[model samples]
Each structure stands twice: as C-alpha cells, then as structure tokens.
Target: MPRPPRGAILAVLAAAQFTVMLATSIVNVALPQIRAGVGLSDSATTWVVNAYGLAFGALLLAGGRAADLLGRRRVLLAGLGVFGSASAAAALAASPGVLIAVRAVQGAGAAAVAPAALALALGLHPPGPARSRALAVWGAVSGAGGAAGVVLGGVLTRAWGWPWIFHAVAIGSFAVLTATAACVPAAARTERARFDLIGTAVSALALTALVWGVASARRAGWTDPAVLAAFAAAAVLVVAFLRIERSAAVPLVPPRLFAAREVAVGNLLTALFGSVWIALFFFLPLYQQQVLGEDPLTTGLGQLPLAAANMLGASLAPALVRRVGSRTALLAALLTEATGMLWLSRIGAHGSFFTDVLGPSALVGLGLSVAFVQLTGLSVAAVTGPDAGLAGGLVNTTRQVGGAVGLAVLATVAGTVTSHAAGHQPPLEALTAGYRTAFALGAAILAGTAALAALLVRRTPADGPAHAPAPQPAASGRP
Candidate 1:
C-alpha cells in the first residue's frame, strides 16, 4: 500500500484523538438528563463519568505496551472497533448500570487509542522543528477536543437527546477508523517482547482502587469503611505493582524510564496542570448553570473563549520556547496559570461571564496549552525510540490519574465548605464560596508546579539534546 501524505495521516490521527478525548467530558452537560432518563441517584450518576475515567486511567500502561508489541496501527484499529461498539451500546442503554458499564468499555478503548495515536504521530514526524510543529497541531486538537466535547454534548442533548451524543461519537469513530486503515502505515511489532500480565493487573487494580476510594469519599465521607478499605487495597496493590516491575523480565513500564530528570519533572508538571484543568471543567459549568441561571447550551457557548485561547496558546508555544527557552517558558506558564486560577477564584453568585469567567479562563487556557506542548516534548525526551509509546502512556496516565484524584479531593473540599457555609450564608453564596476555595487551592497547586519546574527542568532543547538517542526501527510481523 502506498503511504499517505504526512499531512493526511496527521489529520486522521488528530480526528481519532479528538473523538477519544471528547468522550471524557462530553457528558458533563447531559448528566441531569441522563439521571432523569435512567432513574439514577446522584451518587450513581457521578459514576457514569468516573467509570470511564477509572478504566481509561488504569489500563493506559498496558494499552501503550500493547501498541508497541502488537503494532501501533493494529492497536489503533482494534481500539476504534471497541470504542465504536461501546458508543453504540451506550446510546442504546436504558438502565443506569448498562450506561456505566458501556462507558467503562469506551474508556478502555480510549486508553488503547490515545497512546497509539500519539506514538504514530511521533513516528511519522522526525525530531526538532518537524516534530515540534506536529506536536503543536496535536496539542491544539487535544485542548480543543475537550472543550468541544462539552459544547457538542450540550447542543446535541438540547436539540435531539443525550443519547445522540453517544451516537455522534460512534459515527465519528467509524469514520476515523476507515481513514486510519487506508492512510496510516503498519509498524513492525516487537517479536520477542512479552506482555507483563502481573504488572498490568496490579497497576490497573491499584489505580481503580485509588480513584474509586477518592471519588466515593465525596458521598461516603473520608471515614467511611468502604472508602478506607479501597484506599488500603490500593496502597497494597501499588506496592505489589512496583515489586512485579522490579522482577518482570519485560516490565509493562520499565522502571529505569523514570530515572531521567526531564521525564520525571515533566510528568509531575503534567499532573499538576491536569488537576486544575479537570477541576475547572467540573466547576465552571456548575457556576454557569446553578449560580448564573444559564442553560446547558448557554453554558457550553460561554466556554468558547477558553477554547479559542487554548488554540492560540498552542500555536504560540513553539515560538515561546524558542524565545525564552523550555524551562523558562514552562515556569512562566505555570505562574501565569496560577494567576488565572487565583483570578477565577473571585467568582460570585451575581457575576457576569465576561467580568468573572472569560478573561481568567482564557488566561488559564493559554497557560495550559503552552505547558502541555512543552511538557510533551520534555516527557518523551528520555525514552529510546522503542519506548516512545511507553513514555506517551506514562505521561497520559499521570495526567488522567492526577486529574481524577484531584477532582475527588477538590470535590470533597468544596462539598465540606459548602455544607459549612450554608449555615451562615445564602445557598448561592455558599456555593460560590465552595468553588472559590477549590480554585484557590488549584492556584496553590500551580504555584508549586512552577517551583518544581524551575528547579528540575533543564535549560536545554525542549525535545531533548540532539544526541540523546537514535531511532530504532519497529518490527512488522511480516518480513
């Protein structure tokens, strides 16, 4: 088969990426509809989102390794099949249990797709300016995809129904699948490499337990027996995973990968950025809906400025890195992010969108986009070509896990603060206080991230030193 042009390949990959990411937050606006339709309680409804996140975050490492061993193209195709099927099933689901189950399946498929898509794009574009340009496009799509998910969800839900959102995803996934098979080249597999089943099991179980514990704690309280049990189980399983990696001949995650200063620092920063980002998405919609009396569609429209700003930030990142150096750029962005979060913390029950939300959101979006692209370059800098997929998986895994954990913790804080303030203030005022507290905490997190980046990230090539390593051709099952 003749290879497609590089641009065409990237377009397909970006579309697939967008679809996968869209699934993460698209349902936010439709949550109320889903609950009413399925007769789900508030606790059960939250699971509709958490189920997907838990599966996606837990299985990502295994997914990344699968791509490297089974082949990126092959894994991507399989992922699309699973994702499309699951989306169709979700659209048809009538029961709360069924919807949650299928959403988890969708997440598993997404885990498979994301790292493979990234690795494929990286493989196609050589390092330096070419890779940076490609990454800029990819980063922009990712940022826009998350925002689009929320907007599209609201539009489709209002116009048609909540189920239509899933239907759209299914159609989009199928379209991308067709394009991928035709345009993307098949990469060679690692013939001798073995899957680390034990490592995979422990890591997945550990993450699931941790995320479940935190998410459940919001309703169940921190002292709940179930939550305590889950946390303990997670700790034990994490230790087991580390031990398994130490002994496994072909570890799912090579322990040595974390030794690189750039990789380590980059992942930490990703986690911090991801934490605030997820929280922002969760709370801002609530602010617009419950506090400002905006409908779902209006709330979605209100986010356009942030999405546009995110694109602008991605487009400007490469230049910023060139002008200021990766370390300095990252530090500045982190500080900027912190400032935006602080600004947003001033939200009030009577506030207008332009005055209270727009400027701060755009600032946060810009800072996050710049940080995302720079971090992507830093995170993968240490890995050999053979492990690029693994590196991608690790970076994404941290962000997802961090976001999940942070959301749970932040939600608990907000809930507690709101409950306390309700005794002394009006309901809307209490709610605003809760959100402000969470945003303030988020700002502190970015400040700490900036300090870490300043101290740890080197003042060198954002993509790493030119002589760090050479590309090793991946094997194809066929000679």
Candidate 2:
C-alpha cells in the first residue's frame, strides 16, 4: 500500500489516542449511577476506576517493547480490538465485579496502543513544524477528547444510561480500527530482538502491588500487613527489573532514559499532572453528587469551563513556546495551575461552579494543555526514528503512575479528614474538610512540578546530545 499522507495518518492517530484517553475520565461522570446500579460500597468504589489504572500503568514499558518487536500497526490494531470488545463487555456487565474486570481489560488494551500510536505519529512526521503541529494536535486531542468524554458520559448516562458510554466506545473502536488498518502506512519492519520477559513480569507485579497497597491504606490502615508486603514486593521487583535491564540483550526500557534531563522532568510532570487531574475529576464529582446533590449530567456540565479553556490553550501553546522558552512556559503554567488549586482549597459546598470552580478549573485546563505540549516536545526533541515508542511510553508511564499515586494520596488525605470531621459535624461540612485537604495537596503538587521544571529543563535548548543520529531498524529500543 502507498504511504498515507501524514495529515491523514495524524488525524486518525489523534482520534484513536483521544478515544483511548477519553475513556479514562469519561467514567467519572457516570460513577454515581454506576455505583447505585452495581450495588458497590463506598470504600470498594475506587477499585472500579483504579483497576483500569493498575493494569495500564503496569504494562506500559512492555507495551512499548511489543510495539517495537511486533510492529506498531499490529500492536495498535490488537489493542483497539481488545479495548473495544472490553468496552462492550463492560457495558453489558451485571455486577460491579464484572464491570471492574472489563475495565481492567480495556486499560490493558490502551497500554498496548497508546505508545505505539504516538510513536507512529512521530515517525510518520519528520522533526520540524509538521512534527510540532502533529504533537500540538496530540495535546489538544488529549484534553478535547477527555472533555468530550465528560459531556458524552453525562449525556449518555442521563439520557440513555451509563452503559451507553461504553456502547459508544464499542462503535468508535470498530470504526477507528478499520480506518487505522487502511490508513496507517507500514513502516520498514525492524529486525526482531529478544525482550526481557522477566523484567516485564516483575515490573507489572511490583507496580500493581505498590499502587493497590497505597490506595488501600486509606481504609485498610497504614500498618496493614498487606500494605507493608506490597511496598516490600514492589521494591524487590524494582531491583530485579533493574538487574534484568542491565543484563538483558534487549531490554523493555533502557536505563539511560532516566538520565535525560528533559525526559526525566517531562516524565515527572506528566505523572504530577495525571495525579492531580484524576484527583480533581474523581473528587469534584463526588462533591457534586454527595455534597451539592447534583445529578451526573449537571456535574459533568460544571466541568465545561475547564474543558473549553484546555482546548483553547492547546491550540495556542505551540506559538507561546516559540516566544517563551519551554522551561519558562512550563513554570508559568504550573504556577497558574497552583494558584487555581489554592483557590479551590477554599471552595465550600455552597459555592456555585461558575463562581467558585470556574476560574480555577479554566486555569487547570490551561495548565494541563500547555504543560502537556512542552512535555511532549521535550520528550520527543531528542528522539528520532523508532525511539519514539520508548519515549512515548515513558511519558505515558509517568502519567499513569502519577495518576495512581495521586489518587491514593488524595484519597488517604480525604478519608482521614472526612473521618475526623464526621464524628461531630454534618455530612456536607465533613465532606468539605476532605475536599479542602485534597485541594491543598493538589496545590503543593503543582508547585513542586514548577520547581522541578525550572531546575531540570535547560535554558539554552538542544534536543540534548543524540544517543544516535538515526537508529538501526533493530527491535526493542527507545528514542
């Protein structure tokens, strides 16, 4: 088949990426309804969401390797098939256990596709305006798709039912998969290399244990044996993974990726943003439902201020960077986001979304969208050829891991505060205390991201030193 136009390829890839990410936050808009229908306990409700995160975060590096060893198109197609089918199953699920199980499968499929699809976009477009534009679009779609998902989820849940959101995904997956097969040109297939199967397995096990343990501690107690064991196992698995990477002929993730200044900071920021974003999405909806007594659709609508601003900021951010250095832009965006979060720390249940949440939400959206592009540019700047897979994977891994950690920490803080306040106060007041604690922590997180961005990112820019001018068509390596 003739090579598809880069434009066409990007549009398809962006839609695919957008749809995958959209699924992440879309469910939040319908969580209340889903919980009621599935008869989930308040404490157990988190697993419904976190299950997807655990699987996606655990398998990312291996997914990148799969893309490299197998083929980006092949991996992407397989992932789409899995994700779409899982969505269907989830929609039809009769119990919380079934829904959670299917969501996990969906997340696994997403892990397989996201990095490979991103790598394909980078590889298809050469470095320059074209590549930048593609990345910018990628950033925009990231926010836009998520925003669309919120509206879609609310609309589907209110109008049709929560299950329709997944049903829509089922249809979307089929269409995107067909277009992907027909449109994405096959690249020159690389010579297959051995993959670190042990490393992959250990890494997966370690992260799952660590995340589940930390997340569980809010209810299970800090001294819980399960928590202690999880941390210990994660540490051991991490060490094992490092050893395997050091010795393996072809590792899933090269050790050197951690050393790159831009890559490192970029990953850190991605994680930070993911954590805060997920926390906001999760907690805000709870506030709306439990404290404000709003329906799912109304709650989703309340988020539009942030969503629309994110889209606008994403469209303009590339130009902003060409003027201000990426480091400066990133810091500015972080500070702005922090300010918004700080303001949110004072938000009461009685306040309106437009007055109390609108300003902060818009700033958060801007922060999310702008910082995302800078992170992408930095991640991809030094990357050329197929290393895009690993680079994309690293950025994504940071986001997923950060999301999981952020959610755990926030939940812990919220639970502690809410528990304390519950003994003496009305439910709304107690919930407000929990929200304040969580939002305050969110502010600290953004501030930390700003400081890190300033220190690690170079003022005088270079994609930095090249690992290689161009890569050989060898398998299982990063950009």
Candidate 3:
C-alpha cells in the first residue's frame, strides 16, 4: 500500500475523529434517560458528562506525548479498543457509580485517539494547500459529528433506550478502529521519552480542582470559604504547574509557540469562542423551555440552525483562508461572531429562534469554522514533523481547558443572575433574566475576541516571520 491513498486515508482519519466526538454531544441529550436507567441522582448525572470531560482534558497532553513516543497508530488502536470496551461496559452497567467510572475511561480512550489522529493527519499531509483543504474537511466533519450527536442521541434514546446509545458507541468505535487498522499507517519506531509524571499529576489536579470549585460555587455562595479556598488553591497549582513546565525535560506546553503574536492572540480568541460554544448548549435549552415552552426534543431541534451553518462554514473555510490568509480570516470571523452574539443577547420575551437565534448561530458557526482551521494550521506550520504531535496536543489542550473554564464561569454567572432575579420577578421572568445575562456576557466575550483579533490575530506583512511562508495556502503552496 503505497501510503494507502492519501485521499482515502484522510477520509478514514476524519471518520475516526467524527465518531469519537459524536459520542460526546449525543450523550448530552440522552442524559435524562441515562439517569433514569442507571439510577443516578440529578446531581450525579452531570458527572456522567463531567467525568468524561475531566478524564479527556486531564490526560490529553499525556496521550499526545504517548503518540510521539509509542507511535500514533498504536495509540489510536489502543484508544479505540479501550473506548469500545468501555462503551460496552457503560451500556450494561446497572449502577450509577459503575456507569460514571466506565464513562471516564471511555473519555481517556478518546483523549488518546483524538490527538494521535490529528498528529497523524498532519504527518500524512505536508503543510500545503492540499492539506489545508483536507483540514477544512476534517474540521467540518468534527463539527458536524458533534452537532449530529445531539439529534442522534435523542432519537436513539427515545426509540431504543439510553443504554442503546452506549451500545451504538461500541458499534461506532469498532467500525472506526477496524478502518483505522487498515487505512492509517504506523509510524517507524522512536525512542520512548520519560513520561512527565509530576506534571501530569499537577495539571490534572489543578484543572479538576478549578472546575470543581466553579461548578460547586452555584450551590455554595461565591463568598463561601470553601469556594475561595478552591480558587486560591487552583491559582497556586497553576503557578506550580508553570514552574514545573519551565524546568521539565519535556515541558507540558512549549513557551515558544506563543512567540508569534498571531498565535498567542489567535489562541485567546479560540478560548473565548470555546466558552461561548459550550455556553450555548448549556443555556439554550433553558431559553427554549422557559421562553418558547418547548420540550427537550423541540429544544434540540431549535439548535439545528447552528449545526447546519457550522457544517456549511466548514466546507467554505479552506477557500476563505485561501483568499484572505489565516490572520485576516480569523479577525473577520471573530467580528462576525461578536455581531451574532450581540443580536442574540437582545432577544425579547416575544422573540423567536427563527428571528433571534438562527442569524447569530449562522455567523458563529461560520466564524468558528474558519478560525479553527487557521489556528490549527499556524500552531504546527513552523514545527517539524517530530514536534507535530506536541503541537496538536497544545491546540486541543487549549480548547478543552477553555471549554472547562468557560462553561463553569458562564454557568456561575447565569446562576447568579437567576438567584438575584428569583424574588425580584416571576418564574419565567427570572429564568429569562438569567439566560439573557449569559447571552449578554457571551456577546462581550466575542466582542473582546474581535478586538484581540484585530490587534493580535492579523498578519503584519511588514513584520512577518523571517521563516514564515506566505499568508495563506495556495493550490500547491503550504498553509
């Protein structure tokens, strides 16, 4: 197999990523059923999701390093195997604790698969227009998978049962693993580096503690001593983690990646978008429920615009980048998102999704679709093949950490508004107040991203890197 046909290989890798990410969103819509079937308290069901995120985010860097050392295909297959087995176990679990445990393991498998597959993609395709086109397709596929997951999970859970969703994950995992075995090539052997044991522990603990504090803060007042302590401890752990990274043989995050002003600002914009993205999923259901009086199924349907637009934008991203360059494209995209969010935040009690939500979602999806490709392209473009895995890890790590923090912060803010409005207004009024607060804050976040983009994400032709390639990918030129 002379490289397994580059186009087909890209397709297979894309399929593998889609299936893993699809499992994530699909499970969210099925949360209620999962709780009933597995005997989880409402509070505990949130863990079913968080458990996965915690495992996935915490160990992703380690997984990327594993690919660099153990080989990408090996980790991919191992991840698939673990993910499938865990899905099967999750489907069969009778107790909430057992189900939660298996879900975390399943996420660990995902963490391993995701970064390795991305690293493999970068390796297989050189930094050129072809690869950029492939990446546009790949990024779009991922976004589509996530968007489709909600609908699919809802349908499956309604038709078969929540357990069937996990069973479906098992089936999907097996299919991708088999295809990966055939299409994805194994890298030549490399020396295994010492696993960064101390760094791993610190990063995991710090993230878990930080998210835990924020999530719990809604129940415990912000002034609560425990909340303050957790926040303080998180700051300390972060400082310590940085210190460890500064001296470690293999730093968790390479400091030099931020040397490019564009990369640093681009990543910040990404982090803000990441937060807003998750926040939509978190609070939109409330708006649909309280405002429009739609049920869970109908609520999911309302989000279809975002999904459709995201896929649409993804397909267009490569061409957009080809024309405008990564830096300019990112700034344009951020501005679009900010505009959409501001419109969405202003919706009155009488407003409809068709009028209020759809327009912004369209912009958001389009904006994000373009920005992600450019961000990923710039992150690894300067590095050699050997460092590609680490580059992939760094980008994904930024996303996961951002999502974790952003969701928590937004949730806390929404909760605060809801609490303040509870006695000040009627039930629907209070709920709307809180939802609007979140949306308004999101608007601010996106606007800030736009400003950052203008300042940091744009290319300065005058001060371009000496080694920097041209601004965008050409038909045969590198991205």
Best by TM-score: 1
Can you give the lDDT of residue 476 in candidate 3? 14
Write one digit per residue (lDDT tens) for candidate 1, span 9-59: 999998988898788889998999989988889888999999999899998
lDDT per model, in order? Answer: 0.85, 0.79, 0.73
Give the lDDT ranking, best first: 1, 2, 3
Q: Write the per-residue lDDT of candidate 3 for residues 185-303, one digit (tens) a residue.
A: 66545556677778878887787677666666655657789878888988899999999999999766667655555455545656677777767666666576568676556666666
RMSD of 1: 2.2
TM-score of each: 0.96, 0.93, 0.90
- Regions of model 3 farther than 4 Å from truth: 252-263, 348-351, 458-479
Model 3 pairs in collision: 128-478
Clashes by residue pair, model 2: 387-478, 387-479
Total clashes for model 2? 2
Candidate 1 yields a Cα-based lDDT of: 0.85
Measured with C-alpha atoms, the lDDT of residue 8 in candidate 2 is: 93
What would you estimate as the lDDT of candidate 2?
0.79
Q: Could you say which candidate leads in lDDT?
A: 1
Question: Where is model 1 poorest over a 10-residue stretch in terms of lDDT?
Answer: 464-473
Which pairs clash inside model 1?
188-475, 188-476, 189-475
If both were scored by lDDT, which would come out higher, candidate 1 or candidate 3? Answer: 1
